[model samples]
Target: MRGVVLHAPGDVRVEERDDPVIVAPTDAVIRLSATCVCGSDLWPYRGVEEVDGPSPMGHEYVGVVAEVGGEVRDVRPGQFVVGSFFASDNTCELCRAGYQSSCVHRVPIGGIGAQAEYLRVPLADGTLVATPGTPPDDLVPSLLAASDVLGTGWFAAVAAEVGPGKTVAVVGDGAVGLLGVLAARQLGAARIIAMSRHESRQALALEYGATDIVTERGDEGVARVKDLTDGLGAHSVIEAVGTQESMMQAIRSTRPGGHVGYVGVTHDVALPGMDLFFSHVHLHGGPAPVRRFLPELVDLICDRRIDPGKVFDLTLPLDRAPEGYEAMDERRAIKTLLTV
Candidate 1:
């Protein structure tokens, strides 16, 4: 088997590695049909996140089950499946409440890496969801999107309590943020505002159902969202970029009684208690319980109700993951899909 390894910042290499195998009764080994580089992958690659040593890369994946452990009964060999970045025991109390990302036995699959031909998925029965049947080739990329970006965006919308007739705003124009617009539309929001300075991302956001686009960011961005909402601010705002400015912009762009669903992986962020205490707004979000929405997302993709795969503007073979990373980091591609 071959997989990419990150020896240091800006350094990625694809080379032969030992094949992954089932090591737990609840584990499953799947031969990846497709995988991709995530926005989060750039953190370590850019040295924003510490790279202790050579690290395995990738987490989003869609594939066919090659093997399954004895305890994995929900999936079987030959079945095509999509899985979340974190493996969770769906039976846990947290999972039952639709927070599988924090399941009692949750495991981060990033440790094993999915940018390879094979991947060992823990908590297989809970983490992996099979499509209605083997998906057609065209639906593969959309299905892969459901495994992460789509699911995360959906979770953000839910957390923000978006509903028909409500005005919504998205703070970032990245893949997750663009999907947030799609999720808002699916949830019946009356108006969706996408904050993006990039014309390409702005176009995608519009196609995804955004009614307006705010080219400014930070304080200016918040004011723009408010201006469109008649100075009342949007009813719901999705914070997809985990940055201090983005977070504050999201909070400031929401109505007093509105909600802000933040799904960005936080990095050295702190909220001013005085401001939040008087904002009179609802706040919720973290690692999205993608597993919580996978089943429905998979169905939507298979039915062709959404085209999230368009996020993957750049596609390359798995071995060229380094180039894919560079493309995304350099803003040359919104997202990169790696073919196995």
Candidate 2:
């Protein structure tokens, strides 16, 4: 089997690796059908995140179950499934409370890496959701998106309590933020403001039902959003960039008492406690409980209510992952899809 491995920053390669097998009674082995590169992958690619040795890379995946452990009864071999980036025993207290990302037995899929021919998923019954059946060829990408970005965006919208009659602001124009705009619209946000400087992404945001687009940066961006909202700021703000600047923008663009749903994989960030205390803004974010929203997102994708795959502007073979990384890092592609 072949998988993507990062030897070091600026060095990603596809090399032969041993195929994964069911190692636990709660585990399942999946033969990946599709996978993708995430924005967070760039951290290591750009040398921002340290990598001491060869490490597998990828989390978002849609695949067919090749085998299942003895304890995994719900998901059987040959079933097509989509799973959250974080694997969790859905019966845990946190999972039962709808926070599977924080489950007591949770395991992050990226740590194991899904950008390969096969992946071993822990807590199989809890983490993997079987699709209606083998979906149409075109629907594969959408289902794959549900495994991460779509689910994260949906979680962000829910965290912010976005719904009818509320104004929502989305910071960051990456795939997750773009999907956040879509989530806001589906959640009944009356007005969706997507803050982006990229024309292409902004256009897609509009197509996804964004009511307005702000092309400014930093304070100017917040001012534009406030101006559009009559100086009250948005009722809900989705922060998808996971950076200091983007976080500040989200907080500033949101009205007092408004909610901020941040789903970006936080890197080096230090929140100002005083500012947050004074602003009276509510903040909620961490690894998204994608499992909590998996069922609904799967139904939406199956019914074609949303086309989250639009985020993948470029598709490449799994072996060409290096090019995929370069394209995304160079801003030449919004997201990259890898076909196994």
Candidate 3:
């Protein structure tokens, strides 16, 4: 099979790789229909995250089940499925408590690298969720988003405790943040303020239900949120950019007792303990337990209730995976969908 590997920063390639096969009784191998470059992928591409050697890339995916191991009774060969970056036994104590990403038997699917023709998912029965049926071509991207970004954004909204009559302020304009706006709307946020500098992203944020857009960033951005909320900050804030400035901005943009759902893979952010002690705000986030919401998100896509696929503004063949990474790194595209 052909797959993507990163030789170094600013370097990505498509190369021949060994095909995946079931190695565990609870594992399943799926032939990918589509995959994509995530914003997080930029971390290593730009060298913020170390690439020790030729590292395989990608995790978001939607595909057909090519084969299943003996213990995988929840899905069968020939069924279409979507999964999370982390594979977890959905029956575990943490999973039952809605924290599958932290399940006791969790496995990182990123290690398998879905940016290829085939991927081996362990603990398959609990990790993979099938769509109502094979989704049409038009719905493929949306379903693919559910595999990661959409689910991550949805988890952020839930963590923030967004509710009816509350205001949501999202920091960041990447796919996750933009979809955070959408999730906020779906979760009943009465007013959503999307902080973005990109015109294209701002437009999509409005389309996704942002009631307001703040082009300012940093301290000015927080002040803008306060200005829009009568000196008080938003009722909920979603921090989708993992940076020192973005994290502080999110923390300062919410009212006392408000919630901040941060889902961006934090790079090197450190919060001031004294500030946090006095902020009187709630903070909750981490690697999203996408498996917890895959079923609902898949149903939403299959039912045509949401269209998160719009986040993928660029599409390329598997061989052009390098170009996909370049476009996203340069911000020429929000996300790139790779055709298998």
Candidate 4:
């Protein structure tokens, strides 16, 4: 099989790799139908996240089950499924409490590398959710989105407490942020403010239900959000770009008692305790427990109630993953879909 490996910063290659085999009673091997480059992947590609050596890349995937261990019963060979970046035993206490990302035995799919012809997923029953049927060809991209970004965006909205009559602000306009706008709308946020200087992203934000667009960033962006909310700030803020500036913008855009849900992978961000304390804003963020929302999101996509797939502005053959990564890293594409 062929898979992606990052040799160093700016070096991503698809090369021959060993095939995956089930290694645990809860494992399942699936032939990837689709996978994509994630914003988080850029951290290492840009050297923000150190790479000790050649590292397997990519996490988001949607595929058809090829094999399942004896213990795996619900998911079977030939079923199309989607799984989150974090593989968890949904039966665990934390998972039962809707925090599958923190499950007792959580495994990161990124480390395993889904940008390949095949993948071995642990906690098969808990981590993989089967679609209603083999999804139509047109729905594949959307289903693939549900495997990660869509689910993460939904988690961001939920964590931000977006709800009826509330004003919501989203920082960042990446795939996750764009979907955050969609998620906020679905959760009934009365007004959504998407911050992005890119016209393409700003247009998509509006298409995804953003009522207002703020191109300003940092403190000025925060002020614009406040101005939209009549000087009270938004009731909920979703921070999808994990950066010091984006984080501070999110915190500052919310009202004193408001909630800020950050789903971006934090890199060099260090929050000032005193400033956050004085702000009186509720801050909550981490790896999105995407497993918890997979079922509902799958339903929404299958039913054509939402179109998160639109986030993927470019698609490439699995062998062309380098172009996909470059497109995203250069901000020439919103999201890149890799067809395996």
Candidate 5:
């Protein structure tokens, strides 16, 4: 088997590795059919996030089950499945309460990189959700999208309570934020404002359901959002970029009693207590509890209500994942899909 490994910053390679096997009763082995490069993967690739030794690299995946442990009954061999980045025993108190990301037995599903021929999935019954049989060839990308970005965007919309009669603002024009606009529209948001300086991404955002596009930066961006909302600010703001600037933009663009649903993988960011206190805005975000929304999102995709896979502007072979990283880091691609 071959998997992606990061030997150090700015160095990603495809190396031969031993295949994974079921190690626990709740485990399952999957042969990846499709995988992708996430924005967070760039942190290590760009040398922002330190990497000591060789480490496996992907978290979003969609594949066919190769083997299942004795205790894994819900998922079986030969079934196509999609799973969240975090593995959890879905029956835990937190999971039962719809917060699988904080499950008592939660396990970070990072060891077996999805950009590989085969990998192991822990807590199969609780972590993996089987799709409606094998989907059409074109639907594979959409199903793979549901494994992470789509679900995260959907969670962001739900967190912000985006629905009919509300104005929503989305910061960050990355894949997640673009899909957040789509999710907001699907959730019934009357006005969807997408803040992006890139013309290509802004175009895609419009195609996905953005009611307006604002190509402003920093404070100007916040002012544009407020101006569009008649100085009251948007009722809900989705922060998909986890930088300090993006976070502040999200908080400042939202109305006093509005909510900020942030799903960006935070890095080196510090929130100002006084600013938040004075703003009276509600903040909620972390690793998205994707499992909680998996069932509904799966149904929506299966029934053709949404096509989040459109975000993948470039596709590459698994062996050429380094190119995918470069394309994203250079801003040449919005999202890259790797076929196994």
Candidate 6:
């Protein structure tokens, strides 16, 4: 099989690799039908995250189950499934509480590399959500999106408490943030503000249901949001870019006693205890418990109620993953879908 491997900064390659097989009785090996490059993948490609060796890449995937371990009864072979980036037993105490990403047996799937012909999913019964049927080619992208970005964005919206009569602000124009805008809209946010400098992204955000767009950055960005909200700030803010500046912008853009749901992978961000206390904003985020929302998101996509797949502006063959990574890194593509 061939898959993506990251050797160093700006160094990504498609090369031959050993095929995956079920090594655990709780695992399932699936042949990937569609996979994509994630904003988080850029962390290692750009050297923001340490890479000690040529490591496997990719996590978001939708595929047909080729085989399932003896212990995996719910997800059978031949079922089309969408799964989270983090595999979980789905039966753990944490999973029962809706934090599958922090399950006692949680496993990060990136190391397994979904950008390949096949992937071995641990906790198969819990991590993988089977679609209604083999989704049509048209619905594949949307289902794939549910595997990660859509689910993560939905979790962000829920954490932020986006609902009817509330003004919501999304800080980040990436795929996840755009989807967060969509999530906010579906959750009935009365007003959705998207903070983006790129015209293309701004357009997509509008199409995704954003009522306003703010191009300013840092303090100026917060001021614009506050101005729009009559100096009280948004009722809820979703921070999709994990940076000190973006985090602060999100914090400042939320009204006192409002919620801030941050899903961006934190790199060098550290919040001041005093500032948080004074801000009086509720902050909740971490690796999104995508598994908790997969069932509902899958239903929404299958029903054609939402079209999250629009986030993938570029599609490439799995073998051309290098180009996919480059396009996203250069901001030439909002998101890339790699077909196998």
Those runs of model 6 whose alpha carbons end farther than 4 Å from true positions after fitting are: none
lDDT of each: 0.94, 0.94, 0.94, 0.94, 0.91, 0.95
- Which consecutive 10 residues in model 3 have the weakest lDDT in total? 294-303
Residue pairs with backbone overlap in model 5: none
Pairs clashing in candidate 4?
none
TM-score per model over all chains: 0.99, 0.99, 0.99, 0.99, 0.98, 0.99
- What are the C-alpha RMSDs, in order, of all predicted structures? 0.7, 0.7, 0.7, 0.7, 0.8, 0.7
- Candidate 4 has what TM-score? 0.99
For residues 137-215, could you state the per-residue lDDT of candidate 1 as single tens digits?
9999999999899999999999999999999999888899999999999999999999999999999999999999889
Residue-level lDDT of model 5, residues 1-340, one tens digit each, is 9889999888999999889988999999999999999998898888998887899989999899999999988999999999988898999889999999899998877656877888799999999998888877788888888888998888888888798999999999999999899999999999999999999999989999999999996899999999999998999999999999999999999999999999998798899999999889989988889999888888888888889999999999999999999999999998899999
Q: What TM-score does model 3 achieve against the real structure?
A: 0.99
Candidate 6 accuracy as lDDT: 0.95
Candidate 5, residue 37: lDDT: 93
Please give the TM-score that candidate 2 achieves against the real structure. Answer: 0.99
In model 2, residue pairs whose N, Cα or C atoms come closer than 3 Å (at least 3 residues apart or on different chains), thus clashing, are: none
- Taking the tens digit of each residue's C-alpha lDDT, what string does model 3 give over 131-189? 88788999999999999999999999999999999999999999999999999999999
Superposition error at 196 for model 5 (Å): 0.6
